[model samples]
Target: MPVRRRRSTALAAAVATATTLGATALAALGGATTASAAEAPLADYELTWGIKQSYRTYVGMFGSFTASEGAGQAPGSGAFTFTDGTGTYDTTAHTVDLAFRGRLVSASAAHHFEVTLTDLRFDSGAGEITADVTTVDTSGATPTKKGDDVPLAKVAVTRTMTDMATTLTTEAGEYLGSDGYAGAAGDPLTVVKKTPPTTEPTTGPTPGPTGEPTTGEPSKEPTTDPEPTDPQTTPATREPSPTASTSAAPSAPATTAPATTAPTKGEIADGTLGWGVKESFRAYVVGTVAKGRVTVSGGATQSAGNGAFTFKDATGTYDTDADKLTATFKGAVNFKGHESGGSYGLDLTLSNLKATLDGGTGTLSADVNSLGTQTKGVVLADLEAKSGDLKAAQDVVTVDDVAATLTAAGAKAFGDFYRAGTALDTVDLSVALSDDARLPDGGGSDTSGGTSGGSGTAGGSTGGGTGTAGGTGSTVGGTGTTTGGSLGGGSLASTGSDIPGPALGAAAGAAVVVGAGAVYAARRRRTQGRSAE
Candidate 1:
């Protein structure tokens, strides 16, 4: 009995000691969990910009666009000052600058030349804090043809924290005449917020057994089409037997599209076109040509009197060469002022519209005429399409560096709207067609709205050209969208799917309870033994 009693006491002492030690360990672990929660990884970002413009002076007679002696509206002629990193995020707040550095066009008629906008206090912001323009100094001019930067008076700057992306817009009257210039400077500036890239764990092939003997055939041997593991079947990869003709096949129609043909001349004159018209345009906008584009879809409906294809608010015609298509439209494009975005029309004729018979590859050029009634703000009065290389392939069209000119009448009507002689030189377009108008195994359709090989199904507009044309809205700057992307910094930490520390703590507590229960059971068994003795 004494021995049993001693054993019981020893067990009890052991339980108490373990309980104390476990409690201390658990307390330390809890503290550690709290500390880890307070510290997490952060991200950082910065801001930047780029510019796009035309360069030429409004000329007469044939409305020729000549090179300017001073600052040309040409691209790469502009400069950006104030400073970069204007929109940096910190723990407390962000700081930004509202300024630009470029050769600006003045409002004065005597000196219809270009001046620099150095230190022109516009509005700016950083992270959440914003600053307003307070100074203007456009007193100097650069005799050369590129943009020059001029300085302005200093103004008091203030800042505060706000949880919103910063946006910049320079109205016509922002600082054109405030300093010593005549009219507004360049196009309105629009900055877009960039998304940061997220990090993911890299995955690699599983390691093979270290010392296992080679058993199955080598992986290099080519095998016949293997059956899918899942019972479900896809028409694309399903191998059909000769006797499977009775089976309902989904891909049967896809194989039959190779027999299509081109359109007829009657259909072209009567405004009825083949499916390639819409598909080709779709292919261009989404593929290339446009930057910072929102969307591009099929335009208005077609009537019998119109031409072959109808884009938004416009109609088109195919030339007798069977290789060209001309589109025309007129309407209000913007709503800034009576002259800003009203009464405009143009005839966009595309050449080399035919694609190769087998591969669907070719080139498409433009003979765009900027002709129509216009308002005072219609800077793009007339555009005589320049002979340049344009391409069409796989139901898509593309053009690069195609030059044109603005009308002299349009320039004279610039009153308070734009720089009188600003150029409208380059015009570019990219169109990508959707599935309906996609060229079949053969080639594209004929000029008469008829298919060349077999007959193809008509395509519907998927709302390509999604951007609001001529409408006032923010534009994508020359800087890429990932500029202010997050890097490891002091910003709020973001762990997309990581396990939490608190959950681990709770799991540890559960483990302690389980251990305690086991100890109690052992103690009870020893007591029972003592009683039996």
Candidate 2:
């Protein structure tokens, strides 16, 4: 690897329109589209980028960003994700050109700014990254707009294409004039291969749909259906079933299957779960970088003073004989900031947080919406509770401080902010297997116990002011309280140069991909920071 100063998220996806991207590709390859493209295996490469974290946070403070057409935000880091990466990396020539597909829009009506990242060209041989852009600004008199193909920032960096850190060119600075920023140091970009498991868009449907449609039988439907069609309504079509066959073939197993569930699993009537995700990241979103607010509802509570979030009304099953447990908690926590045009630059929702355990090995899952898309039952963290920690007593099972780490799947679901195996806040859970069973009365299982910042006398770096998430020792399964408080406030601990701070604001310069005619509006200008010039 070549030596580097620092690394930032790169443009894994381009928000450029189809026409513009095609032109860029053709121009880069000397107009031999059909000749060169087929040789590259465009589908193999993957790229992840956040443009500029500080700028993204600034935009999010007013409006929101959305990715569509097979593009998304990294679960671990909230960066833009683009796949089907196609390019030529020629070793002999010492040249590399990588182009990606997809589109992204960061709009903020409040700031009177909206820009779509259209096209980007990373020419390793030339050490240059250029962008084509389109912007909409109502902030000025009579709404000024730049063309979709406006040649935007062109920066220089190292020749390697791994995780890229970008900077701005003089041209970018001139465009910004006094309103925006033109400087060194942008966001980070990561380039890697798109694995087969993550290749849902390409290969997934082929085997699952084509092969299964021929073997065609079970995976698509419940074999328990009495017949292929409803016998009562269809009657004469195949007419023999419901009345005559009720006592025979399909009926017995259908009824029996329902009865078997009760024996194999123990029902949960009462329970609670306490978890806080990654403390630092949570702190970031609530902190200066994000300036977002966190809300808990659906019967959840926060312990006093930035305590662990407690999800209540647990309902699921525990298989004591097999040492397996599936507990689902009610309630939801939403983090939103960067309000613009009724959209948030940052929006994440975690609801119906679930936990599963067997032989002390377990996982936590949730219905997550981070990239303007909702994915249900996404396994987020792997639970590491020793079997001894999960002992059942008096018809109740309590697990405390069960360690949690991000999984690959969790990393993908959360935004690629952190890699797999990164530690999250410890988990504490309790489930009552019987009517007389009871959960702990308060936030006794909290691990962080951090009220202010958390180090000495509590840290200001989110190691404080949790002051609100799980309610202070509220009763589990009681009428849930909807508590609202921001995760980040006050000043940031680190404000060194080189890192983008909200102090010098900018908007929509993140990817700066080109989109000639596309436009959306950002919401309220949360604070006077930057505008996409």
Candidate 3:
């Protein structure tokens, strides 16, 4: 009995020491948990943005568009919604990296475009949202793909998640294969952040591994402490529960987009156009045959050394999708010679030239004054510029001597000086685009690569540009309902759509599993403990 009493005393002393030390360790561990909770990882995100409005409106005319990976527009709404978003937010850095699912396709008469957007990276310091973009243009006949992981747009975002307005970058314009896309506005964005979920602290006094009941009151000495193998030592396994830390787990932060600077309607404020009516016509007017001279007025100036005519203060629109240009210039040129008795055999003047490009043809219209007979909007020449014949650079589209044929009306305008369908001068033309404007062809012109009444289709990612003259919307999903597309998209829902989200609940669950594992270990140690004899 004495020996047993000695053992009991030693065990009790050891238990006392362990209880004190475990309390200290618990205090320290609780602090550690609190620190961990403050730095929670991002578990999920919901981001919303439309690519661009006018672009959508133009493409929507091609009928509704289909979506991929379950991304689609809200019913009857122009905004798009993406669910199950996945990404991370860095609290200290105030940055976010995210990715969503969705692919959109649009087409006009003779052209098709496919765009997929993902991997959005937001930097608060830089105040930009950069996304990886991939696109395919079918106008090249082979469905050329470009802009793989391109920096497509600039976005505004900060830690507070305000002002998610977006606009396309010049790179996006290049990705879309048109300068008119630069600085195009998109829908304002919104964010819904998901936090890392913590395991709830178990209720009541944590059950001891030993099946004994505990007093229902808090105390310095725990009845749950097990017998120490040595009086000088406490149980090596004693530790605090993860409950305190998990409960304080923080949530993911919000995301925002930046702003844009441009004319609201994306219209041209000022521009210029350079074109020469015809090389042969100009020479003939100055040659000994007609014995005539050419004169210019009204903002029209001849280039130095008898170059092309340069007309200033141009006003018009450029269509990127259709690769069409509609512009009217301020200028006039007159050719007069062959004077007779109160009559000049050759007298011609062309003014206010208007240029229109539709499908594969370019038309030059002008106000003609032939010997006192005035005519307006006369189709003076038909220009056929082949692909690779025109060069575009930094807001300038250039054509070097494209083939131009005189039209029937043009012959009469010249007092029948030349017959209808006569070979006119090779045409030289150049026009500049304005940085302050965006021309998305919202009822601007019908110059799609296909003829006015030709058949075309909006194609799908796989393939679809086939059907009637108005064409069908290319699609892979049935969610596409034709509410806003220009042509027929039999399977897509076109409501001025936006982007979607990704799934990331697994992140929060992972941390929870870690905390639960620690609790399980504590219980297991207690369960395997042997009672003091």
TM-score of each: 0.28, 0.39, 0.31
Model 3 C-alpha lDDT per residue in residues 1-533, reported as the tens digit of each score: 00011122223323333344565653564533422332223334545665554344333422244554535664322455454554433222223344454454443322345555544444333444555556554344334555434556667653335447666676755554444445655456655443223311222134332221122222311222211111111122223434444544432111111213322123434455556564434443443223345667776766532335666566787654456766787867776644546565555678898876654478888887765556678898887776533233434565555667779767556544445676555555555565532222111121211111111222211111111122222111111123443322122223111111010023322322232223222332342222000
Residue by residue across 214-311, what tens digits does model 1's lDDT show? 22222311121011111112222233543376454556646645633333221121121121121211211121111111111222222121112222
Q: Rate the local accuracy (lDDT) of all candidates.
A: 0.23, 0.49, 0.44
Winner by lDDT: 2
For 1-533, candidate 2 gives per-residue lDDT tens digits of 11111211122112121233565764564443332332222224555666655445344434557787657875322578776665543322233455566677766554455566645445454455544545555455324444432333333433334566665554433332211235434556555544344433343323322221122233422222111222122224323544567658676556544432224356887898988775445544444323445566777765543345888888998877777889999888776543546666666778999998888888999987763667788888999885544466655788887889888767665445456776677888888876665567746332322222211111111211222232221110001111231112112222111111121223322211111001111211221122111
- What is the lDDT, from 0 to 100, of the residue 521 in candidate 2? 13
Show where candidate 1 strays beyond 4 Å. Answer: 1-404, 408-533
Q: Give me the overall lDDT of model 3.
A: 0.44
TM-score of model number 2:
0.39
**Runs in model 2 with CA error above 4 Å?**
1-43, 139-143, 147-160, 170-181, 195-448, 451-533
Report the alpha-carbon TM-score of model 3 versus the true structure.
0.31
Window of ten residues with lowest summed lDDT in model 1: 490-499
Better candidate by lDDT, 1 or 2: 2
Task: Please list the residue runs of candidate 3 whose C-alpha ends up more than 4 Å from where it truly belongs after superposition.
Answer: 1-266, 304-307, 341-343, 388-392, 435-533
> How do all the candidates rank in terms of TM-score, highest first?
2, 3, 1
